[model samples]
Target: MKGLALFAVAFTGALLLYATGDFPDWGSLDSPANGGELSTHYIKEVRKETEVPNIVTAVLADYRGFDTMFETVVVFVAGIAIIAVLRDFGNGSRGYPPALANNLPEEPDLIVTQTCNLVIPVLQIFALYVLAHGHHSPGGGFQGGVMLGASYILIALANGVEAAMKILSERKILLMAATGILIYSGTGLVCLLLGENFLDYHVLSRILPTDPIMARSHAMLFVETGVAFTVTAVMFSIYANLATRGTLKGGL
Candidate 1:
């Protein structure tokens, strides 16, 4: 059985390597991704069509909205799966194991706690800025959400998991995650109900005061906000579960 497994691994590895030989050379000017008609169209027309200064945001949130929506769903689903498998609702008071308990200090360091207290607020404020300004800049929902979630994780590390949970409780995490998905899906559903194809943001101009192009841009922000909410909730939930061995108790 061991020999058969080894053979299968080697054969698969060889096939994958051989297949890579057929791919275009790295960064070739004529490579499909670089020179394809679709790529050209996006580069030439994205800003004019969507009015979003950031081409990447316009593509992900407008031109390829369905794909990005599913990608967010994938992140949400992964968090849910980890929680379902590892969460221990009834064992909230169970502290860390003996090994971890011995290594950690009984009290959080004053300097570290103070520093985080100062830095965390600034960090979260910057996160909101990133999320709100993404269409016009380099940042976006995923990046902002990560920063927001890291604020909670920093609280956990500086204080304790329990301290962080006080701000973002388990119940809030689930609600925020579900609410993010709802916001994204609801936007598409509204479009559908308005007799436009799902996620067709141009149709939103009928309800919004903006013109068609601006409506698409504004709608993108809405969906991006939804993405940020889910990413923020899921990031903290995963850390809390892993750091606490699903009990969501005690420090890491």
Candidate 2:
């Protein structure tokens, strides 16, 4: 197994290194990716098409929404899978083997708790900022949701799994995850109901109180929010389940 793994790694690395020779030179204006017909079209048409100043956001949230939605589903599935696999069974206190469970400390560290009290709120605010700011600048749902989840993790580390659960319980996590997926999928269904293709945000203007271009922009925001909700909930759920063997009473 080790030999096969080593050979696979070496072959993959060699292939990648060989492929790099065909890549455009650093920051070359004439690079195929930067100067291609598609790139030129996107550069000229993105703002006019989506009304989103950030081209990356316009591409990911609007131009490529289908891919983004499925990727969110994949992340949510992985989180659920982690819970299914590592979850503990039988009646027992968790976070350690039965033999060690009785020896675990129940009290939280005061210093860590206090520090998190000062930091977590700010962190979550910043996460929301990132999620909302994506249309105009850097950062988006995935990045912001990870940041939001990390704040919860920090709380878990400072206090306990139970403490984290109090902020967002296991049942609520599942609900939020489902809700996010629903928001994403429902948006597509709405587009379909509007007599257009799935995820055709421009068609949303027929039902929405906005212009077609503005409708696309707002639809992208909703899509990003859906992504953020699923990402945040799934991320925290994975951590809680793995850290506490799915009991969610304590986390590392």
Candidate 3:
């Protein structure tokens, strides 16, 4: 029976890998991706409609904003899961102290540390720039949010997880994650209440007639900011938990 199960598993894995043969070639410039109906339509219409140079950004933030909203929720849920699993560990009395205080050797080399320190600030600034210019370019909430998370991870790797957690407290991270979900959901609900489709920014403009586009832009910005904040915090929290072999004391 065990041999049969193993054979079945291997067969299934091989079959799944074989299925990829039907997929588009890895990077064919003339492939369907470059000339398909959907891609062609987006290529033509995206710039005209969203006025964004980055079609991917326009699609994620505007054309398919609803999908992005749900993606943010997924990230938020993952954060919550990490927090719940580790909450007990942060009993206020037991946790790994900061590396510097713990007297761990300063990571055995300074070059990587110095390089990361210099690059991290620039990366963070670029991440924010990407978020802000998403309306005009190829970056947006999801990409920007992940970049933000990466920035913190770089910091944690440089200084230490404890330092990262100090900069962003676990309690605060939990609250922010919850807040991001709430804000995304609440925006949709508010639109529904206003008699427009859920997340209809046009309807929101009626309340602020003088600056409808601005209002829409602001709402999107806020939503993205929430996403970035939650993602960055949650990622660090995960790193802290994993690095310590799930022995860290702080609650998720």
lDDT of 3 by residue, 1-252 (tens): 999999999999999999999988888767877868888888898655544566776566555778888888888788678756755655575665555444556452588678888998899899999888877767766677678878877777777766677777677777877787777778778878999888776567767653555556656666677667667667766777666545553212
Q: lDDT tens string, model 1, 83-166?
A: 887866675555555574658778899999999999999999999999999998998889998999999999999999999999
Off by over 4 Å in 2: 1-19, 89-105
How would you encode candidate 2's per-residue C-alpha lDDT over 119-155 as one tens digit per residue?
9999999999999999998989899989999998888
The predicted structure with the larger TM-score, 2 or 3, is: 2
Lowest summed lDDT window (length 10), candidate 3 = 243-252
Error of 1 at 150 (Å): 0.8
Q: lDDT (CA) for every model shown?
A: 0.92, 0.88, 0.71
TM-score (all chains, Cα) for each model:
0.89, 0.88, 0.71
Stretches off by above 4 angstroms in model 3 are 1-41, 87-115, 208-219, 247-252
Any idea what lDDT model 1 has? 0.92
RMSD of each: 2.9, 3.0, 5.3
Q: Could you arrange the candidates by TM-score from highest to lowest?
A: 1, 2, 3
What's model 1's TM-score?
Answer: 0.89
